[model samples]
Target: MTEITADRVGGDWLSAPRAQAVFAALADQGFAAYAVGGCVRNALLGAPVEDLDIATEARPEETVAAVEAAGLKAVPTGADHGTITVVSEGEGFEVTTFRADVETDGRHARVRFSKTLEEDARRRDFTINALYARPDGQVIAPLGAGQLEDLAARRVRFIGDAEARIREDYLRILRYFRFAAWYGDPEAGFDPEALAAIAAEGAGLTRLSKERVGAEMKKLLSAPDPAPALGAMAQSGALARVLPGAVSESLAPLIHLEGQAGSGPEPLRRLAALGVRADVDLRLSKAEQKHLARLWEAVDSGAGPAALGYRFGEALARDALLLRAAALGMPLDPEALSEATHGARQSFPVSARDLMPERQGAEIGAALAELEARWIASGFTLDRAALLANLRKK
Candidate 1:
């Protein structure tokens, strides 16, 4: 009975020619197709719809044949899992056959393709994500009793029993917090039942792959304000379960500092603010690991913002300053921020080449290091000639 206005669902992505073509192909083949999950949920919430996913009564092979018959390309991207990527006009849309979970073992699920939309909706994680919309913007009412209300209230609740849902996939424990951070209402607070279920299932988190946990953490940290959700995770014991010794207290201050500094969410920086060694629990890229290591190094070095900027560049310097300020519960220094910007643009005037001849081999590197320290200590005011004059004195 719930319906989204045509105007709301009529965004460019939904109405694009290619999208309509895919819908038409499924309709012509007499398979009931509806834009499902995040696409429908985000559209109704007036949030950005990143991907268009369609759930159909058509079997995977049938879905494939229908798209190809319509002169569109069908790639069996997840064919074994009842999904096919239907390509039209160079854009790909994930077209999946409706499924019902047959068996689940905390990490993976074996699903059976089902013809009923109700079955498909029931198997989804959250109530809000179970709503569906037709190509023409007619939204099929969610089968769950309070789902529509949950969506309107900005509440992210697991479908059916929370513990049952979590047991189906331990990763849902982290996903619960991630979704809460991104989509749930911070003021409303998280659902107590969900939090309790998560707490009871905390041990299941250890079974999830580090990469999956890392990806979820990155998304959670990238939210506009993740502090409230993170605090909830800590309370539910899920935070400690995933990241031992991680604390959420400093994150709020860091977020406030970021706002004052006009910096958007930086997941790695926020993760650093948590003050845990994530390199062990999370699978970070080499570049991310190095950047994280440098943030900690800069913090421990007791380096001024200017020095941090000079050594790590402006962006990192700002992160270090913000993290340091948050740790100390102090307001950011405006002058220090300006100095960071200034220092990032400064180039050291004392390279090894400048120390060559007078200083050779290992001595050249040693001399350059000494002079660069003096140059930076001088607030970078000493030019090449002024710095080289120190060598003459020595």
Candidate 2:
């Protein structure tokens, strides 16, 4: 029963009215209830908690009744799996009965409800994620897992046997890298045993759904510095197992360049930096694939910032230039950055509407494009009249 000072993880989000009411309702039902899993883990790490879940001794139906009795909505988000989402004051808190996995088939688990917290903790994938917290911020850490200590050290380890955990759910292979990228300490480095286990089970990643792999990859690539974790993945053959042609070398410079430019990392851009066709390997959305395509086109165009901005709009043009600079190992030129900013703000002087009857159909379209190109060549300083004059001459 290790205790924690929740106030140290201080933020108004933790003490919100809805989270408090949900916890109180569960406790009032005469059950051992506490905020559990990722919420507690993130709170301890002083990271932003996205969701709040309550683990309780009460059964799912009882949990639903208790929540509804408290004037909140009980949604059976995963009721069959012992989870009932209790909506309090419009915010949803997942209230689940403590359960242990009776069976698993590498992709899904068959869990049986239990009153014991130890079984709940044992069934979890990682020790750091099994922590529980009372409303007042007192954490309940089961003995022997070293969850509290590992979290403090920023260590991410499978709860028991790493291979057994991986066998229970193959997704843990990618999750291991994702968590390592997000939270693992570069100083303490990675756990050797965990790495060895991941190396052995790396091939199992092929069994996962493309969507699951994509989501995890997207998040992992979004990390501020995912290079180290990715490098380890490469060394363990996990990265190649997941994405054959993808490499980590390109990501390293892009991260440094982003930091040097005081810009945040863009996951899509990072994905492009990996030099792979994400549309084929990862389950990226059409919009994401399009964004990557545009980013690649921008990088390959070798166009100046002004031209990039004119073609890609301001925000994307700036990002493209930044990536280009990083790839070239050159300091971001103030002149190029200014040109991109200015170009983004600059509008093309010629429009098809302006050439209506004078130039119709393909001719009109071609002439407008030609004039716009001339205007772009002249630093976008050419006026509509100048563009029209050029169009007329041509």
Candidate 3:
């Protein structure tokens, strides 16, 4: 395989002084280094590249020394995994040594350092991602026969042995579906061997961490056609094995609806469609857990502005309606979404003091609650005088 050089990246991402420094430092040290992985693939697809990863035949120690010699800060982000975080100026890039997996436990791999480019490319997940470019704009593609052909065809083919690759890491099962949703050609159907591998190794998914699973699940659910991929997950029994009670045969429509409704990609909406409670030990952060709880409460209540407005603050209430709108595949009542938001912004028209000496303490609190309820009941149309009159009647 040929490596991507500085010229192929349109000289934009690699134009940064740090990027040049990294390449020059590695080259000066007699090590072959190239910007690899997603950045290379994105450049090919004309997409915006965010992170640039470098792969070298150099060992971790050598790579670190070379980077530091170039006046960059080198951090041992994952030294055992042959990775070093190189920081230049204000930008940080991850550089990893070329490796071949020697041992696999279906979740983690034990890899051996490799000096050959073929050894490195052969270990990747998909074909479209295997192309490497050189600094002078030369693409060294050794993806023989049907591989590059498959990529141009938009087909997601496992690198070598599908079952063997899947056994190395069951997480690839979900990644396959994600890639399909994001990049596959509708004409090129899902690979049978890949699907079979996922079904057979579905049980291994439970061994993975919830945090990893949650991140991948979020990406899968956020895809344009999450229904088909999610349906595949359920059909393969991967969903049941990983999420236990989260597999719902009826979740496809809800996922489809949420995709159409178009909100920020909050995975909880998809999680809810699976019929699983938010309390599952999914390893979500306290803030994430709390946010989901608020959205769930608002959806379950199905009440008018004041009720929803009082229970859930404005932002969360809107999120709930958006979630419902997505699940229902219908537009929310512009009025309802806006009204809840507007009501949440307003203060009580008449506080206890504004009601004068007639109402105070428990009586005052009771009157306020009743007036608020009436204001909500009257389609939130009750004015200040009407609210005061209702409070007086109490």
Candidate 4:
């Protein structure tokens, strides 16, 4: 019976024509449907609603038939799991039948579609995500007695027993911290019982796929401020379980440096700040791995900011400088940072083509290399004419 005021939840998304049409179609079939999960939670919190999901009393095939009868396309996105993607006005809405877990193995769950909202709510990982909103904007909380309070307090508490929830799907271990970073109050801290549960089940993280682990880590690090969550993860031993040798000590300072530089969160940069070899543990894409490797090299090269920018481009140069500053426990130099941007903008001014014929073959490359060094040393102020003149002197 928890109520979210209409003003708080009212928006075009709440009454979108297509979403309303889907609800009408379900109602016509005497099947109840309500917007559920993240869509409802975010709408109540005044956050952007990215995806629209609905939970229904109808079975998966019943949902498909109802939508199809209404001239809407039904996609069996997860039909075996009671989820059907109903397409209306060219937008896809995930319509899932209410389900309860029948069995769990820490990685996968066998669920049975249920007839009641309470059963659906109880199977959810966190209370904040278990909320539902009728198409008319009536909010429903059928699980935790404190579900609404937890959402209002910005707490990410597991439904029922924390350990039991973790045992159901160990990925919830990482998800707990990820949600904390994005939604939980850092000052209020994490739920102690949840932390205890996570610490006890820390080893379950290894049972997850590397891609899933990497994805959760990236999302966690992308939060506006992830240091507090990371610190907690370290204390709970979850950080080491996924990324051995990773520490949270330097992350706060790196975040401070990023803010000072007016930069937004960059996962790989923060990951670099952790001083762990992500490639060894995370399933990062080839491009990401290569970029991370370059970042490490830049930090260790002792190269000046401008040189870094010239070599790695502006964005990566800034990341390297920030990582280097965080590692050294030094404040970032504004002048040095500006110089990096300047270097990224600057061309070599003297390519091998300029030196071709004047010095043929390997000698041309050697001469350009020497000239480029002198040019970089001159703060990139040395023009092509000056560099060529210096080459002539050699």
TM-score of each: 0.96, 0.91, 0.87, 0.96
**Cα deviation in Å at residue 103, candidate 1?**
0.9
Q: lDDT per residue, candidate 1, 1-394, as tens digits? A: 2343443365877888999999999999999899988887888878899999999999999998898999999999999999999999999999999999999999999999999999999899988889888898777765854777787778999998999999999999888888888888898999988998998888999999999999999999999999999999999998888788899999999999999999999999999889864496699999989989987887788888888889888988888899999999999988889999998999987677676677789998778888888888999999999888867887
Which candidate model has the greater lDDT, 1 or 4?
Answer: 4
Location of the lowest summed lDDT over 10 successive residues in candidate 1: 1-10
Give the worst 10-residue stretch by lDDT in candidate 4: 1-10
- Kindly list the per-residue Cα lDDT of model 3 for residues 260-356, writing each as its tens digit: 4454455676676666558576777788787777778888888765557656877666666665665665656767667777767766566677666
Stretches of candidate 4 off by over 4 Å are 1-8
Which regions in candidate 2 have their CA more than 4 angstroms from the true location?
Answer: 1-14, 352-361, 388-394
RMSD of each candidate?
2.2, 2.9, 3.8, 2.1
Tens digits of lDDT, candidate 2, 194-287: 9999989887888889888889988999898998898998899988877888777777887887886677868888876667655756888889
**What value does the lDDT take at residue 34 in candidate 1?**
91
Quantify all predictions' global Cα lDDT against the true fold: 0.88, 0.82, 0.73, 0.90
Q: What are the runs in model 1 whose C-alpha is more than 4 Å off?
A: 1-8
lDDT-superior candidate, 3 or 4: 4
